[model samples]
Target: MQFKNRPNECVTTTDGREVWLSRSVATAVCILLECEGRPYILVNQRGPGMPDFAGYWNLPCGYLDYDETTAEAAMREVWEECGVNTLELLAQATCEFFSAPWDVNSTPRGARQNVTIHHGLFARVAQLPPVSNANNEPDETTDIRWLPLSDVETLTFAFNHHERIADFLAHVEKLAGISYR
Candidate 1:
């Protein structure tokens, strides 16, 4: 089929078909110890000047690099954004595929079409790490915090990350044979 370039995001086939390319992203849901008897999860706020969702909270996530496994990328993002180096990945929580009509003027870079793989990890720490001092990508993340699960519903999240957090919580609940609802 004859190929036509579409600004590196899509290809036009000979038969007038457009095929979109997707980027694989890895997201980590890091569960930490109970604080004041409430379970908390790690999250980061997007830095100012971010291409999309600036100032919004989200799980530690990023596009997977070449030759890197999703789990490896997830762990790396956790360290870069949350400054947490110790984690035991429990499982692959979920995978989500998202796509929309590509608009060159409005679509954020690296989000034309994305396949996000979420991994659930547990961190054994008595206190939260000093993110500002240890974060490797300060430009990508402005703040890192351990958000109590009870407060998730009150915060705004980017890229539907709230759903990912919910899924992880459900998985943990299943494992513990307890239901929050």
Candidate 2:
């Protein structure tokens, strides 16, 4: 099926360029697991070929496939990327994020004027199977690991992912009624 443009979705900039306006909902699942008897969040660094922020480490994230719900997308991304299949939805953040093409005029394949809506969800699990580089999806990532939240602050993340992860962590803490930091 062809993607229809939303009403007033495409807006021409002052530079006189026509671009497509596409909006997609994505899920970023924060999965916690015990490694070496300590709690760690599953994080990943996209391979060097990704169009976005390549090789940047962040949480498990992906766009919602057609006919998939938010929760299902979350679980699927976690499982496909990190080999974690079992997860319980803990909390969904209050705010979602929109990432639109900053340079619509120059972006290739008319992907420039698109806006992406990102949903952040927290997931808990007993443990994770070993992260494998088994799937090939564009720049399929390989350097997957479990790390403390503090590590997130020090590492470089794709887009505003670190902030989003921080937001989810805070939301989880609020839901638990205690500060885990």
Candidate 3:
């Protein structure tokens, strides 16, 4: 049986006929918030003591627990990692798909199994966090900031998040009917 497009699911177009769905193993979220009349993306930096990509920045991300839905996990993670509690899902937006395999030698968890799934989701907040993300968890995140999308290209990101951000921006223009300057 072939997969059918679910309503509001994300699809991409290429060369008129070529199209595909985005997928990833775990969910990562992009929360678009604005300040001073400019759009910004919320990102968190890893703590220096972490095993992987320590000191690198990334979107609010986490693996889905056994009982939690993607959106639930996303909300929980955002609250856990960031101090903001006002974000709600832009559930109508298509989920940007991502695919990749865990390193076999480095991690026996997946045994090199590649996993694909949608993000926690593209969510939104009414405004920037007044006090901002304060990592109260165990040394997971060191800092959080709202940075202008225009300056995104200049920063260092972990896990190819830079490419992910670019993909999100493009999709916002194409599917969301909003253009980023």
* Better lDDT candidate (1, 2): 1
Supply the global lDDT for candidate 1: 0.61
Report the Cα lDDT for candidate 2: 0.59
User: Where does model 1 exceed 4 Å of error?
Assistant: 1-22, 88-111, 123-125, 178-181
Candidate 3: which stretches are off by over 4 Å? 1-24, 86-116, 120-126, 131-136
Ranking by lDDT: 1, 3, 2
Q: Each model's RMSD to truth, in Å? A: 8.9, 9.5, 13.2
Candidate 2 lDDT for residue 144: 85
Model 2 Cα lDDT, one tens digit per residue, 1-181: 9775456467787899986556555666666543454556778889876677777887787777889776667667877777755343233222222122111111223643423333443333455456765664756785888777657778898756677666655655665543336
lDDT of each: 0.61, 0.59, 0.60
Please identify model 2 stretches exceeding 4 Å from their true place: 1-21, 34-37, 88-128
Model 1 scores worst on lDDT over the 10 consecutive residues at 95-104
| Residues 77-155 of candidate 1: C-alpha lDDT, one tens digit per residue | 7777777663432322221111111111223444355555666543334455555526555478777787777888888
Over 46-137, each residue of candidate 3 has an lDDT whose tens digit, in order, gives 88666788899988776667787666666667777776563433433233222221111122233322242334333344556642445446
